[model samples]
Target: MDSIINSRNRCIFGCSLSRLLSSLDGVIQNELARREPSLYQWYSSNQNPLVVRTFVNTFENDRRFNSATAICSEGKPMDTSESDLSLLVLGLFCLAAITKLGSAKVSCQQFFSMVPDIIGRFMDMLLEFVPISKAYTLTKDIGLQREFLCNFGPRAAVPKFANDHGLEISFWIDLVQKQLLRALDREKIWSRLTTSETIEVLEKDLAIFGFFIALGRSTQVYLSSKSHTDSNDSINSIVRCDRCEF
Candidate 1:
């Protein structure tokens, strides 16, 4: 009976994982269609190249206008406020992922190979619209950015780049700790609550902290690797320069 139950649990877990991956795939596809409608239609319908290129150019122009409007409000309440920053980051990341996944679908390159470059490019573009300091601060306050980095591991592969651009891992971890403590304080206030209520509070708090911890770990790993790579490259460049001079 126990063996049967274990097998059932494994099957259920596998099914859930499959569903999650499928949902992620669907999200990528939908966002790609929205971002590059002409490309989507052309590929889907097997249309002519010249017409498709024109359509694509028009679509790109439209997207630039829309993105600019989203990044900067004209005559309206500026949409680039702190409240919308999280959503903007998520949207930009999603768009970058979609572009990489699209390339992967067409080419033989693995998705992993394209993710870091795509994310880096997206971050660069996004920084132009919103200051990195604001982005980091907002991400630190809420745990969403950490959660995102944890979810997309390869996207977190360039910690030095992020740090160089002003995202401090220590600062983010400290913020997460503060948030966790606040949650604990709230839980303490409800100490007289029922067992289920206590459990719920604890679970929510753990979820938030766990996300930050995972993000911190990933960032640390990426930064260490990046630092090593940069060091080695610099040494090699120096050696080449010395040889040429000699």
Candidate 2:
């Protein structure tokens, strides 16, 4: 009876989520159709809508992300691991958006403007996971450049937008490489990390790194299943690092 109850609960939760996503997607489509018909058309006809759909499905009515963004805006210490992890995922979504939609046939200026500040904060937050070394400045001033389509001739924005995304991808690649190495060396340093202060920091790092590893593998499998052949090599390596850590 207990097992049956649990199964029923899981089914109920799944149905609830499906309904929520359908409702939200409908609302978004209606708004886009009214405000930006071109965008709506493109989005509706997009051959691979999985990425954007996944983004919407994951973020719908998610208050945890809302609270995390508010806290980050205030420069408050986001001490909770959930907030930190949420911010990281948010940053990833932002990157993915730039890569996937930057060169699309419609105006994304309004969308881009709203996210620059958040992306800036996310860049700063990402640096916290990385060690301050001569290789990387503790506070690198990397901003998400918004050269939207309206600012210049049509399609002119793609270069700068791609450059900004390149900066983010480079930073992520470096961080992932370092984390992969650190994760491998963790066993050797287990005894040395016995101190509470060191252990706490290490635990946090491990948690964040583990999130990246899991996300990477999922991304790899997703791209593979989709037959994405022309993906960037660095991004491919980032996703392929699943084997390295596991």
Candidate 3:
């Protein structure tokens, strides 16, 4: 009896798996592309994978924007502001993921088409998890901690970077809120979201921005604090201050 039941289940599983694999084949893909003409081009037209990968790497590492100095018209490296660097990081990471996932490997345009939906889901999750007063309290703690981290740091570099970090944090936070609003375009949608949603979005933004706050500000705080406090416990500390490459 057990063997008969097992054989029946195996047949069912095999058929389902075969169907799933067949669905991803070129015939169905071409049909999908024909139906949604703008979203998917013929996969045969893709650029070489090696070339795309190299271009992506170079684009992400372009140091001219990384530095505070602006690049010159004569091909000299130029100064970059903290805002520029933050923007560079955000753009490279997000767009690179999109290009790398394009039609060759995944349905790139399909994913891009779904970004608004994704943002809406993110807003929903934020509203569910964090309320207004709760968000305010979290933001206040982060703000104070960031301020303290900035003040006690021994070098000017720490303070300057923290100032830049603050600006970028605000930018991304505002960006998420605006994107969420744009996703829900109906007038009725705006009516559904009161100030509570606003506060929820801000708190959610702080949760993400808190990461950068730690990343850009930690070096100075560590160096200053380590000198006075944890000099003996070398194992618990970082040997060098550097940006996480991810």
List clash counts for every candidate, in order.
Answer: 0, 0, 8
Model 3 agreement with the true structure over 13-114: per-residue lDDT tens digits: 335334433545455467667788643454434533555577656754766334322222356433223323333233323333543465566544444454
What is the alpha-carbon lDDT of model 1 when measured against the actual structure? 0.45
Report the C-alpha lDDT of model 1 over 1-246, residue by residue, as the tens digit: 544543443344335334434555555567668889666565545544676588546644654335433433446443333323333455444444455456547442343344444444434444444645465543334334543344433533335445454344333434444554565456543343334357877776556545545654554455455553324433333322222222
For each candidate, what is the lDDT? 0.45, 0.49, 0.39
Clashing pairs in 3: 68-79, 68-80, 69-78, 69-79, 69-80, 70-78, 70-79, 71-78
The local distance difference test score of model 2 is: 0.49
* Model 2 agreement with the true structure over 154-205: per-residue lDDT tens digits: 3221233354545643554556565666765764443434543677778865
Task: Give me the displacement of residue 49 in model 1, in angstroms.
Answer: 4.7
TM-score of each: 0.29, 0.25, 0.19
**TM-score of decoy 3:** 0.19
Winner by TM-score:
1
